[model samples]
Target: MKPGTLRVWSQVHTWSSLASTAFLLILCLTGLPLIFHDEIDALGKAHKIEQWDEAQLVPLDHAVDVALAKRPGEVPIYLSFDEDRPVVNITSGRSADVPEAEMGFQPIDRRGAVAAGGGQTGGVTDFLLDLHKDLLLGQGGMYFIGLVGLLFVAATVSGIVLYAPFARKAGFAKVRRAKAPRIGWLDWHNLVGGVTLAWALVVGLTGTINTLADPITAWWRADALAHLTSGEGGAVQPYRSGLVQKAVANAMAKAPGMRPQFVAFPGSPFSSGDHYAVFLQGATPLTKKLLTPVMVDARTGEVDAIAPMPWYMKGLLLAQPLHFGDYGGLAMKLVWTLLDLAMIWLLGTGLYLWLGRIRKRAR
Candidate 1:
């Protein structure tokens, strides 16, 4: 390459890579184990085959009572249902609505037995996953990580656009000899960055989209759900949600084959005492992650079809797995993980190259 042209392209590569490398490194490192979170969770009592009374399920609140009993001092923060098993999750933490502390989690089965040892963490691994996604920052962390992911996507796109000039038959796979000063690092950059482009771009873009989710949810509430729930005065008063067990039962009745993924109880910013919205999760290759909400009259327990997610939600739902590489089978997942490592390598080398640039100028 000509000297002037080389300088220009070098600057392009440097600035673009530098702009996102630090955040990208954090993302790449944090995301590695998260890619295999299922494997890790599986190791920590994620599933089981236990006996249950198909005739009468332990009531939602009652099952929660079982979990709370199992962990005496803990508050029941979040309750999750089992898709196949008779497992019920009772998280012990202060309610976001009713302010508390220490969310201990327990799992209970159909016969009202807390599972032998469910919700046990793998310590460092669990911490890593949580930190990777949320930086131990809760909602604030999620949003901050999301912004980093967006910058990553921008870097990846600009990097790829510049690749057309750098790509060569050998360059695509090249690692130029140390005999050449600039050529070697340049070759390494193209090789590392090019090879991992698919994975990095995926993680970057998807994570970016995932970050946009909070805003998207707010938008959905403002745009789509508002129409579905008109003239309700926005559930401002925190009404003590009554008969949650019944509301859950009614939600199940409404979404027969579908599954209840989550619930927005009364007094929740999402719902109020007058109504409850149960998100019915879909089951399909593509639709599984998509949520279909069913609203119930909290007092009367009538189920109403909740409005569809806006275009943004749909995009987010799809983008998440593509970015996380969670949908595909084991082999594909492995490929995604390997690529995740590659992204880490790219970020590392990209950082070193930029540092080298700065030091040379300083010299």
Candidate 2:
């Protein structure tokens, strides 16, 4: 790189890193626990359901009815089945458009109409996840975090550009321990940053993409839903029936070799006012994260359309598990944890070096 170009890249690296350092620190701290969120959640004593014959499983409609009986005046928003056990988890709220905070969740045994667990939400892990996701500021916070992720990416790229020149001068991974403290820290930062560059870039870019989830969903709904419901009338009509179970069955019949991951009731965000959107997933690990939506006519309980997610929506779906290292099982999560720790160290040392420079300038 030319001298002027190198100087510009150096300044870019410095400012971008400085701008996002604090938020990045918070993300690292919160994200570490979240990397093992499944394991941590497993630590809780779960209500065990005895194995039951699949043929004897209770109907989905019955399960929803049983769940709604517990929460009076509430309506079912979503119904999801457990892959490992004969249990159905139902989410209910005052209305379809109610806030998540107003929603209630219940796990019901499919073998028998039994409440498997108490309705609960908001725990330590959820708190950490919320903080890691959006700083608890909802949509606006997500946009802010997305901006920070962009800055982090900028820092990473600029650092890589600057590292080429530094490596040629100082040799790769050379930590000048005998030099001044700031110099030593700077050397350590460069070395560690270089070592973790690829992982950092992947996480930063995916995190940024993940932050656009709401808008992406909105776009998918606006475009895909419009296309799917074009002939049925532009406006969503009020659904007439409550054949939730039949709708799911119809969707499954339409999508052979796929299993229902979740069902979005009519008038819900994931469904039109006249259809039940049953999201299906494949049996494999990777495909489990990638969902296909099957829209069933709520009034007639017949298949309306089978809509595969758009490329961008699929990207968002795939990016989520990749961002969290959830697709590769425990081994990958361990690798993610170690990488997260290294990132924390890099952020800390970078901050230390920047402050040291500021102090010297003051003197």
Give the number of the best model, judged by lDDT: 2
TM-scores for the candidates:
0.80, 0.94
Q: Residues 1-363, candidate 1, lDDT per residue (tens digit)?
A: 566875675566566567667766777777777778778777745475656676677667677666666665544445667666777766554442453234466777756454635667557677886787777888788888877777666666656656666675445676658556666776677777766777677667777677777678767766666666664644432323345577677777766677777666544435543566777776776556877766677666677556656678888888878887877778988888788777777777777766787798999
Off by over 4 Å in 2: 46-50, 178-181, 231-242
* lDDT of model 1 at position 148: 74
Number of the top candidate by TM-score? 2
Can you write out model 2's per-residue Cα lDDT over 1-363, one digit (the tens) per residue?
Answer: 789999999899999999999999999999999998877776766745557787898888888889889998888888888866888999988887688888889999888889986445677899998899899999899899999999999999999898897788778999788878777788788898999998899899999999999889888887897577553533444433358879888888887899999998876788777778899998887777889998887778888888788999999998888789887888999999999999999998888887888998999
Candidate 1: segments with Cα more than 4 A from true spot = 1-13, 44-53, 65-78, 91-104, 113-116, 120-122, 137-141, 168-181, 234-242, 252-256, 355-363
| Candidate 1: RMSD to truth | 4.0
